[model samples]
Target: MSARDVLEHLQRLGMSGYEAKAYVALVGAGRPVNGYEVAKRSGVPRSTVYETLGKLVARGAAYELRGSSDATEYLPLPPEALLDRMRREFDGSVAVLRSALPAVAAAPEGHLIHGLKDAEAMLDRAEDVIAGARRGLVMSVWPEEMRRLREAVVDAAERDVEVSVVSFGEDADPFGGGRPGAVYQHKYSAPEAVLEDLGYRLLVVVGDRREAVVGGFGEGAAWGIYTADPAVALMAAEYVRQDIALQILADRVGAGEIDRLFATDPGLLRLLGRARS
Candidate 1:
């Protein structure tokens, strides 16, 4: 990284800008440097350089030395050592907070609904749900999302969690040709047709009958709702179950007949949000 980047990062780690600059200047000097030299090299103001150096010394980020001439010089703690100390301190703080935070407030009682505002957030929550499944998971996902979530689903399956997927898109092998779980390819409509009909790509995931994520993915935009509401979870799971059952029915009968029904049946057309011809 650039020198400016290093200084910025140091500042983020609780150093003042002048302190970071002085520390970097000391490190770059390769020897103990006085306040004047630190200010000259680091562009820190001469007035504040000694104060910044004093702070760094107080923080154990630098050492102060008294030369034979009785002038004070500052030497930086090695970058590796400074980083290691910061890491240890940070981890310790986190560990304390992890145990202490629960005492601060009781968790809210009601099932909460969270909004995921982007595709990455949706995928992350989906992956978390899949990974946390203990009994079963049901999901309707497109090819791209399936690829992204395949590992988590497969891992859950490996843990003996029952996994069922209703996949969309043209790919013949949704799980990259691996049978991680019971996968049903949605043949009732093409992915493009479904997207056009819904005006967005739909994704639903339910885990262990306890939590559900329902979302829409679109070009440069994605949004979703995640809930631990049992009713919502059951609905999302049932949606996938119905899709899987329909796919099985299509396999037993034929895709052509299902298409004919969808095209002609008023109920089916209405479900698809299409007006009767």
Candidate 2:
């Protein structure tokens, strides 16, 4: 990249505009230079050059050296040294935040259901739920939802969170085409009939069996509800449990028989047959 681009990137990493320019100028000089020289070469205003140079020295991005004439000269920190210092500081900050925030934050109360709108919002909540999972997660979702939440799910699994998923769609394995946890692919015989009847793909996620998110997407819209209520979470967990039970039953008794039962059941038929308002 060009020198200007490099300076812009350094500015993004918490350096002020004048600091970046002054640091760039010092590096280009390749030796200790007074503030006047930095201001002249970097085109920074003389009024702020000394203050900006002081900030750079304080921030470990530059060093203040006493010249032969007893004038204060500034030397830019080598690029490698500056980057290493920044990396260490950033890592330390994140570690402190990770421990401190959770300890000071208020405990979540149960029985609260927050309604969320749109697929993006639901997916964001899903990511948070998965990332916060301490014990386990149970979910019923389609390939599209699975793909969207794949990274968070994989991270949870890697952290030893037990993950169980009931994937309903054409593809059998949704964890990046490989199995990462317990996966049960629904095998309704008339998949089209089921899909057409619902008119949307349903998604349900329960984290640690304490928090749950239930939603659907399709038909040009998306919606979901997130609940920390113990009762609602229990129900949601059981909902996924039942799906798992059915998959096991289908495995033992044949998927076709289970599909035939669903097709012939009068209650299911009525519910599926109901017209959309």
Candidate 3:
């Protein structure tokens, strides 16, 4: 990265701009640098250079040395060491907050629902649901989303979560080529036909029959809901279950017959937002 990018990243890691500049100057010098040299090389003000160096020393980002001439010099902590220290500190702080924040305010007990603003957030919520599944997981996903969430689903299956997936689109696979759990290829509706009817590709994920994420993805738009409501969760689960059942029935009765029935039946056509000729 560029020097400016490095400075910006350092500042993000809790260093002041002046401190980051001074530390970079010291590291670039390849030896201890006095305040005058730091200020000259870093473009930090001469008046503030010593204070910035002191702050860096306090933060373990640099070391202060007294030369034989009694002049103070600052040497940067090695970049690798500084990064390792920052990672440890950051992880420790997150661990503490994870335990402390829950005690500060207990979450309200109810059917909590959250709206996901876009596709990334929707997939992230889906991954969280999959990761949290202890008993069972039911999901109806398209090929694109399946690729993105395949690892998490496989991990859940490895944890004995009893995963079942109804995958849409031509290339959908729950675990690449190996099936770790029950994976059914959706055949009742063509993916294009479903998208034409609904205006988007749909995704449903239910975890342990307790939590769910139901969402839609389009070319440049996505929206979804994540809910802990048992009723919503059950509905999402049932959606996948019914899709799986239909796929199984198609396997027995033939997909062509099922397609013909849906194509001609007025009620089914109406359900698909279509009119039978």
Candidate 4:
């Protein structure tokens, strides 16, 4: 409605203030505007008028023609055509940027993000990391984190990754009855079994990757760290394997199949230093 509003909108279309003013002056004058006349009428400096008109011409919003005495007169491009070109260029740029988003979003390093959407994005990244795992995924997780682990495992399995876990039950399959992943149950013994009901603030170490995710709520507020380094994963993997053995022994001890968890079994003590921390 006002010159400022028109200028603001035109600026967003890639027009500079002087160029927009010169185009408006040429169209409003209803006649070709020589450089000097455009400068005077548009309030642009005389030396800058030609350059301003050049910008307008580049955007298809104005044109220049040779006049008598070698003077150049400027004509406003058709408003409809100019607007249409601006829209087309903007759309082209947007499409290019949109196509680049997925590649640009891949993680290059460890990052911390708060909340659900970001957590889901990280899980998606994990799926990308594990999509090629053929032998299987070896992960140790706490019970409260079962939901996301379930979703990620189902997604990974859907894509043909074998999923396996060291979880809360000894002698019980970790995948439950209808799930697609493997769960080596009774994985945490004695004091560590106390960790099952302790919410989802747990660590997950699978394949060559290790992550410590500590969060509360269902999904709205959660955070995780992911890394794929060998030394760290080896330690976690060994611990989880030992946890599975411990869960079995603890189950036997609780069931009176074995009277003692210690003093009688040298193997259990040997594995204690290796269980989940």
**What are the per-residue Cα lDDT tens digits for candidate 2 across 1-277?**
9988988898878898888999899999998999999999999999999999999999989999998899999988998999999899989988999999999988865467899899999989988888889999898888878888887888888888888888786463546547634787776424465578788888899999888899999987899999888788889989888878877898899977876776778776565564334
Candidates ranked by TM-score: 3, 2, 1, 4
Off by over 4 Å in 3: 1-56, 65-87, 94-99, 107-109, 146-151, 170-174, 180-182, 260-277
Mark the 10 consecutive residues where model 2 has the least summed lDDT. Answer: 172-181
Segments in model 1 whose C-alpha atoms lie over 4 Å from true places? 1-107, 170-174, 260-265, 275-277
Q: What is candidate 3's TM-score against the reference?
A: 0.70
Clashes of 4: 6
lDDT of 3: 0.89
Candidate 1 — number of clashing residue pairs? 0
Error of 1 at 237 (Å): 0.8
Question: In candidate 2, which residue ranges exceed 4 Å CA deviation?
Answer: 1-110, 170-177, 189-192, 260-277
| RMSD of candidates 1 onward, in order | 5.6, 5.6, 4.3, 13.4
TM-score of each: 0.62, 0.65, 0.70, 0.40
lDDT of each: 0.87, 0.84, 0.89, 0.63
Structure candidate 3, residue pairs in collision: none
The all-Cα superposition gives candidate 4 an RMSD in Å to the true structure of 13.4
Model 2 scores a C-alpha lDDT of 0.84
